[model samples]
Target: MTTTLIIGGSSGIGLATARLLVARGDEVHIAGRSAQRLDDARLALGDAGTDVATHVVDALDAAAVASLAAKRAPVGRLVLTLSGSEGAGRLAELDLAALRRAFDGKFWAHLTVLHAALPHLAENASITLLGAITARASMPGTAGLAAVNAAVEALVAPLAAELAPVRVNGVSPGYVDTPWWGMVPDADRRAFFDGVASELPTRRIATADDVAEVVALVATNPNLTGTVIEADGGARLKAA
Candidate 1:
């Protein structure tokens, strides 16, 4: 059985992906900062929870992340679904500290997990990184987010080459309906989703499952190294 480790798997895209992989019979180990949320996620996986394990560790805590990775050595598939919108705003007016926080939370966090698991990653294992379409699209209020995600996307090609048989790929989703938008009030979030859905070429905001399918594809397909699969509902095709 393939042992897969997913950071930030307590909720949202990470949890959705874990559900998919669990259903597919992978030994999925999920790590995050919230014990309760992790427990909930495992329960949410239903009877397949037998294939799931939960660890409470923040991605920002390098030592904790490293310890978890070491304990779960020989990980065959590594998926990173950690990111944030902390630094989102107009570039000129954006607080530099907030941008740094975004980087720390997203870019550095991803790297921390990657490096921590580097030694223990199985030979010919695959890595799937979850970023955002904002990395490529020229959006007005997402410059910081763009920078953070772009830094992540930037790792695909080079790492794929360096890692050789170990595949590296990225999944950049547009605006998925996930807990990432929990900060926005429910009504406002719904309205925002409706507005974005109308503007997208697909005419619908993606669900976490939608992006999870793409992540699974990237992780399992041997020929997909260094490729970035955009599951953005055509957001890049038409700016919002």
Candidate 2:
């Protein structure tokens, strides 16, 4: 009977979490920017007769995001995994306009969704935000991402206090095998992942399912809040 709203839930960590939560007997509704992708994820997940809803949402539109929450009132768990790279490049070549757009996609999206859903959060509800190791494991060519992720982590403590029984926490994952990697050519991606793998304590990049385990843990734990569980395979330990 617990309903979870997963923004950006059509793929990667979001979709994997959807599957895991459903398997554990939770009704899930996935909102994504692409309807086709959402549908494909639903078919692949085969929600096991559990309620699995999908929506086409552009997180940049605050009104729409808020309206969705109003429509789906009483969300017991809210997980947001929305990610974008609008102005991703060296600071010297940065485009201010694109950077603003990127903020809307990531940081602003988090605020808007939570603001709209606050009224409907169930008792003892949990809110999980997907952060990145870039928040601390600063790598070159990731300045924008690092700033944005750090901003997200900055919200955990304050929001946790304000939200109270509705626990709010975050998870920062390292490189994972997800569609985000599909953007690279196979050979390059393999090489990159192999290079990262050798340095990783886990010796393997995380799968979406691997990160989902932590997301689920954060959602169900009653004693956790104002904290972030780093699921970055110890990448933060090595530094950038």
Candidate 3:
């Protein structure tokens, strides 16, 4: 069976992709920061015909990421849907420490996992990094996030070239209704989502499954590499 490793697969897009890939016949291995969450994801995939495994490897910890990457066998595909607090809000008053934390969560951690996992990658393996619409579009309170995401997206070209037959790409999704918004009050979150739905050309926010579908494509498509696929429901077509 083809082995696919999903980092940050305990929830959101990662987990959704795991379920989809498992259904389509792949040996799925998921990694998360928390043991409980990893167990929960495993339970969620219970009784699925395909094999699914879980590991507790915090993306923020280099040693943990290396260890997890070392143990896994050559993977045919890799998906990273890692999440972190982006310290959203006006930049002038932003907390420097939190800003640093946000960067560490995604871009830095992604490199950590990729570098370590390189040795175990199968020929023609695919790597899809979960990027963001923030990378290309301007949104209020997301200045820091935009920069961080842009940096993450920037890796595609160089990494894809370096990885060669191992295709490297990014899937940039816009405003998904994921747990990433749990910090927002219910009413405010609803208002925020409603606002996006109102203006977006697709008249809806991207969902975990929506992005997951694109991720699956990026993984399986042989002709694509060194590219960042935008799956933002046409939000970029609208202005800031």
Q: Relative to the true structure, how large is the alpha-carbon lDDT of every model?
A: 0.90, 0.86, 0.85
Question: Which candidate gets the maximum TM-score versus the true structure?
Answer: 1
Candidate 1 matches the true fold with a TM-score of 0.96
lDDT of 1 by residue, 159-233 (tens): 999998999999999989988888899999999899889888999989999999999999988788999999999
Candidates 2 and 3 compared: the better one by lDDT is 2
Candidate 2 lDDT (Cα, 0 to 1): 0.86
Look at candidate 2 and tell me the lDDT of residue 164: 89
Best by lDDT: 1
Residues 16-73, candidate 3: write the lDDT tens digits: 8998899888888899888998877777777762378888887767777667766776
Q: Report clash pairs, candidate 2.
A: none
lDDT of 2 by residue, 1-240 (tens): 888899989989999999888888787889988988988888878744246888898776777877887787788899999888575678988777888887888898988788877787887899999889988985777788888888888889899998787899999999898997677999999999999999988889999999999999998788899889999998988674
Per-candidate clash tally: 0, 0, 0
Clashing pairs in 1: none
Candidate 1, which ten residues in sequence have the lowest lDDT sum?
A: 42-51
Which scores greater on TM-score, model 1 or model 2? 1
| Rank list by TM-score | 1, 3, 2
Evaluation by lDDT, superior candidate among 1 and 2: 1
Better of 1 and 3 by TM-score: 1
